[model samples]
Target: MAAAPSGPVGPNPPVIAVVGPTGSGKSDLAVHLALELDGEVINADAMQFYRGMDIGTAKISVAERRGVPHHLLDTMDVTEEASVSAFQADCRAAIRDIHSRGKRAILAGGSGLYVRAALDVLEFPGTDPAVRERLEREHAQAGLRPLQERLRSVDPVSADRLGDARRVIRALEVFELTGRPFSSFMPSREYFQPAVQIGLDVDRDVLRDRLAGRVHRMVDAGLLAEVARLDAAGLRRGKTASRALGYAQFLKVLDGESDTASAAEETIVATRQFARRQLTWFRADPRIHWLDWQDPDLVAKAAGICASPASVI
Candidate 1:
């Protein structure tokens, strides 16, 4: 691997990863830092990578980005089942290009796993078709509960956060095939790159209130309209793209199975649950350096951390 780029240890050639839960204001923070630090934003969010997923994914807009260089947002279609490898390649290229131009690369998003993949030198164990087939059979017979139970037995930490059936099946596949816990293969460095991390923090109550408000705003911002357009575009039902939080839930409304009110409520609930999972993921990571989302000196604190011995030495 190439050596970490040389620089003054703060706000420059090195990478700065800004990661936090949804509604934590990470995207805006990255944009601001980029403007101040000669940086470009590298998206690490899984959902935001897809096109026509703007509002539901809480994607940053061109206007909101304020002429700052942002990479990877809205870079894929919803029909594409993107992977960590694909994101890794794109991120490496973006970062390399930014460095060649003598600017910082700020990776900012809510997807902890993607962030880790980019920052850490992780070796994901190879997939085993037999293991995956067996898991699928078990899931088909007993539904997802048993598979989820098996995952908890093997890698409780990952299982606890990844509670959904699909995630559980994938985790079990990795464990069975690798003969090791999923977490064991993660990068030695928690942040991927040795660059500093600036985590966004907000009061629990404040964040909840903000989330609620954002949900309403999303509705007013044509979230339903966007979902309709996606449907019109022929994204299949149950496909990953069709299953995006707001869009999927609303599709049921459009299908006459539920009312708009109920779908909106379900979307809110799912979004909040996803945020909780995001918090769990970020908390488990030790590389993050906290930045109070409301603090008047957040940027200063981050700048200090970036220049500190822990970051530079």
Candidate 2:
């Protein structure tokens, strides 16, 4: 049996994970669950970790958090690399701390790997700066196509999964360092702790409309201005932060390659694609209990999952 973070207790409450696509109301659900269960939230969204990335990431505002304590948001500088390995350690520690205080730990976000790293028996491969630098140099000199081809030849699974050049390079670096395919390091379906995952489901057509409206709302909420501020703060120097959906599109605007309207449309399209990918990732995990995003009694249903010992463990 899993022990509560406080110590060896009679029965340890399970950690709750709120997961779904980008515009699927996971944040609101997480807050509701936290309030209902006396829980704290640990962020699994990799982008939300950057201190100044608020509006575009749809980070829950202080007022929206509903008096529930949240951990791991705004934890990194715009120029720092977000590491899954580091997040795993920090998340486990946060869960333990919340448990010590006799509150449940709610892990919330759409980031699949980050969530898995936190709650599953996943081990990250070691990184070598020399290898990474070589891959970076190759990418800079030869572009993504050549490196992507190399990754395709070596790790076809990762090649199919990774669309961005940075990830492709990273996968190649891992293969070079370990003499093993990057996919070989993928974790089996085993929980690192007693946990329950609640995934939000939505119809694809409705989700597309919702995502488009959300992108428009974000733009109206000053997403361009937010990107401007981060750009000034050396956002381009950050390997991970620079590639965030909204941020990347707007950066093209700043570079005179796109306009605000076009960037908004591009972001919407990219987000829709990303949402599909997120669904693919979470749906593959048979462990997640899916709930419809539009359910009228959403909070109560999720709360039931938290309260039921059989459903949780």
Candidate 3:
């Protein structure tokens, strides 16, 4: 076996982020790297922010963490929406705290925007409630197609990229607020802080099968019950949490609109699609050093990357 790299030295090592699609073993690899590098893990997975969203999200258990300190898990209630702007502040604070203690900070998740917000030179545009409210009203009155068409007219790039109604509406709102294309605000490849992103590369065929099986396992592990518990806690009131992959589908089961088997299958399909989107988003970034997900020396290789001065961006 290869020897572990001595790990990054000096008081302010670059932030390390493990990023890839769901079911790519990012959390386990992050924990291993944290143990090897004497670092702490900070979550970038938006869903993992909720307090009771464990089973469906596959959040690492306290024991599974292997005693490495983790930050930003379960920091919000189910009824609250997860905010990328808020997360940017919180994530930066965590990174500062970890670096102050002379330890590396490892950010692990597949949330592309959240990952970029933490590591890249990104700035969020402020929202205007009046504009947002007006756009939302237009959406409700005229439906999504009209708003999507309007966004395409003003910001074609964002129009082409955004799929959901909420994002499309948000794009329109941004255009009205700033007279600038929402895409103009996208973070450039430049790092906001010294950082390195390690991406996990998995074969699409293998990843598809793995995601299907993982969704089934989550259901068998009582994901439905977990969703029920959160729903009772007003999860449906949450704009973001209500739409999460497994939680959304399982809520239909709770509503008598679907069965457990059907919900599990839907969750599997949705997860696979989500993983594809994640791959697409991460692949566009040229800086991520991708390692084979199946590599036996994955942690050692990642630690080696951390220790190498050249890996710092």
Candidate 4:
């Protein structure tokens, strides 16, 4: 755990990080917690940043939010790229504003990388445009694996912090510019403001059931129509926005490559796999207080943890 700076801020209530696998009801918990604590939620999901990506990303609707304030969701369109550094910067600023206003800030989502980056994955280098262009070209030609391997060699430290996609791009950039892995510049660890983290989870059977039910509801909610709309807008297959679960599968269906049942099947399988990956990423951090989905007082427990004295945060 990183030490809190010795200052007046030490006595303040901790910022809360709500994390968990998909289909875990994390967003519901966040809204209720925010209401309880006079807090506002800041999105930590990478996918939820884009506008018109509501259904696929499972973004909270205004009605679902129950009048609680939220931030960072729908802050960008699919055409624009969002990154961890930009998220980190925006989140830090938001946290500060919340503190100043005497309100709690809740960071919520299943994207472990975004949450971790906002919390402590600091001292990592920012992107360089020229290097990014060159590396992007390389990635376009030779593929991401080679770039990832290059990252593993030069900047294993930084590479280890990034997921495969980010690692590959950044490593290639570093290699192109400096003939080295981008890892050398990374410090062992960097500090962040004190924060309480809670990860929500359910029994495997329960989780799968919830996921399947959600997929069925999405089908009813015109998820296929939504995908067709995106396609009509020219967001084609290979673009990041089009790669979201259900979208790609539906697009294939739209393109006559598969049928509705096949698309739904593929989407459901992919969503479950994504949930598993989310679980794997977060389980590494022992700092996150794990709460069972059935825990009746889960919100209270999380609030208690946020206010505890032993919190290294």
Candidate 5:
């Protein structure tokens, strides 16, 4: 086991967040930093919250965690929808508990919004079930075109930025319920607490290759079987989990709409696109310290940063 570094010279060491695109090795880096800093991890990956979403989400195995404590993984049922507001509260509580025990809290994962909700001074607009249901009905009746136009009229910025129907409908619902543009609640680059964000920088071509290999490995590792198990557990009814990259593609296979090989190919393509979006989201934040994902001494380099004064910012 690696020995942890000495206590921070400065008062109040900030929470450490390891964030980057999918397959950039954020989870492994989090474990390494935890071992060297007396830290526990708080998961920010939205999909990893589901109990049986292991292979597709690339969740760290028990052995891989290497005895480091992790919070928020496998905490939700497949049928449950994850709320960022709920996650923010849980994450803050976990961080406080970790700090009280004199341990660093390392927040890790690639879900850009979840990560921001956990570490930034952001608030989710309250939801109205009635408004949501109405919009959902409208979408079911006429599809995304009508809703997209409605959103573009009321909140053009959000509509332009959100390409997915779910997000667009939610934005419209927010506008209806709050009587304000959904983008008005957009968080500035302000931290909810003291924190340091470390981002993994990977070469685009290398990342694409890595992503394809990862999807292939997931298939060989029984991603389809995992999906079957979850599908039996009502995965199809789970709005969020059903839309996950590999899960979504594999679901089609299970539905007799496609085969494993074709589904795997689709998954690789979708995952690559998702990675690009992740990079775009994380790159917009100026506070992140980018380090090469392939660095030979990544753990040591990261540890040094955690021990330095910059770690508190």
Candidate 6:
């Protein structure tokens, strides 16, 4: 068990973020903390933002929320892209609203960047349509190698970091628009506001079993039906939502390229892989106070951390 990070120092209470890999019970723990602390939950999970994505996303149900208000969940249609910049604004606003009402703001999710965007001193560069279009055209005409070379010339760090053509193009576009390396815009650990992050640490073998069982349960809970319904609603047109873990695999089932059993297995594998990546991402953050996911005193420990006085920043 790591020592808890210092708590909030100013007039407002700290934004409490419960972070971990999927199937680590972050949602349930957040709800419990909210009940204990008189807080409202503001979702940091990007996938949970879309409406009708409940089953696949494992979104907390209304009854499960237990009358503690949850903000930002089900706020977007499946057709809309989940924008971190937009989410940063909305999440900050939600925090302010919760604070003004004298409630603690509890953020819960596995999406690392989204969690950071809400809590860190991150700036998003503006984009120009013409510049983006030109980059896209160049990528299409000459392939990713040429664009990769171009980006390598201007911003080698971003070039090395970004893998896909879309992100690489966006990196180039940012450099063209801002005359700055895309790496310069990357978030620092400095918080935008006072915040405390509590991470759920689960044993790797245990998490693997949990993720597999969760995927199977999701399939049994009509995940394929949910995907079919969303597919009918322009899901494939949406760049982000269409590629969600289970939704993507189940779409293969819908297209006759796979069976439900195969999709479920694939989803389980992909989800476990994603969980590993999530662990890697969160493990790098020293500020996160990690707790055993199965700790019987988890909520009590978390609330105590929240109550402790923080070092003045």
Any runs in candidate 4 off by more than 4 Å, and if so which? 1-12, 142-167, 177-180, 183-191, 237-239
Residue pairs clashing, model 1? 119-192, 119-193, 120-192
lDDT at residue 45 of model 3 (Cα atoms): 99
On TM-score, the stronger of 2 and 6 is 6
In angstroms, the error of model 2 at 298 is 0.9
Better of 1 and 5 by TM-score: 5
Off by over 4 Å in 3: 1-8
TM-score of each: 0.84, 0.93, 0.96, 0.86, 0.96, 0.94
**Candidate 6, overall lDDT?**
0.90
lDDT of 1 by residue, 182-239 (tens): 7666567644445677788768778877887888888888887888887787756424
Cα lDDT of model 3 by residue, 41-138, tens digit: 99999999999999999999999999999999999998997889999999999999999888889999999999999998898888888988888898
Worst lDDT window (10 residues) for model 6?
1-10
Question: Local distance difference test, per candidate?
Answer: 0.77, 0.89, 0.92, 0.76, 0.90, 0.90
The candidate that achieves the highest lDDT relative to the unseen native structure = 3
Compose the digit string of candidate 2's lDDT tens values, residues 113-192. 99999888997889999989988998889889999899999999999988887789789988988889998889888889
The Cα error of candidate 2 at residue 210, in Å, is 1.4
1 or 2, greater by lDDT: 2
For model 4, residues 1-313, the per-residue Cα lDDT tens digits are 2222221242355778889998888899898788777778999888888777778777889999999888898887665666777888898888888777777788998877678777774645656797788777877898877776677776677666776664568666756666655656443334386777888866988888888888878888888888887677665732457677888889898889999888888888999999888888888778878888779888777666666657545
Weakest lDDT window of 10 consecutive positions for candidate 2: 1-10
lDDT tens digits, residue span 137-242, model 6 = 9888889999999899999999988989889988999999999999999898999877888899999998899888999999889999999999999999887899
lDDT of 2: 0.89
At residue 6, give the lDDT of candidate 3: 41
Runs of candidate 1 with Cα error greater than 4 angstroms are 1-12, 128-138, 145-162, 175-183, 190-192, 237-239, 307-313
Worst 10 residues of 5 by lDDT: 3-12
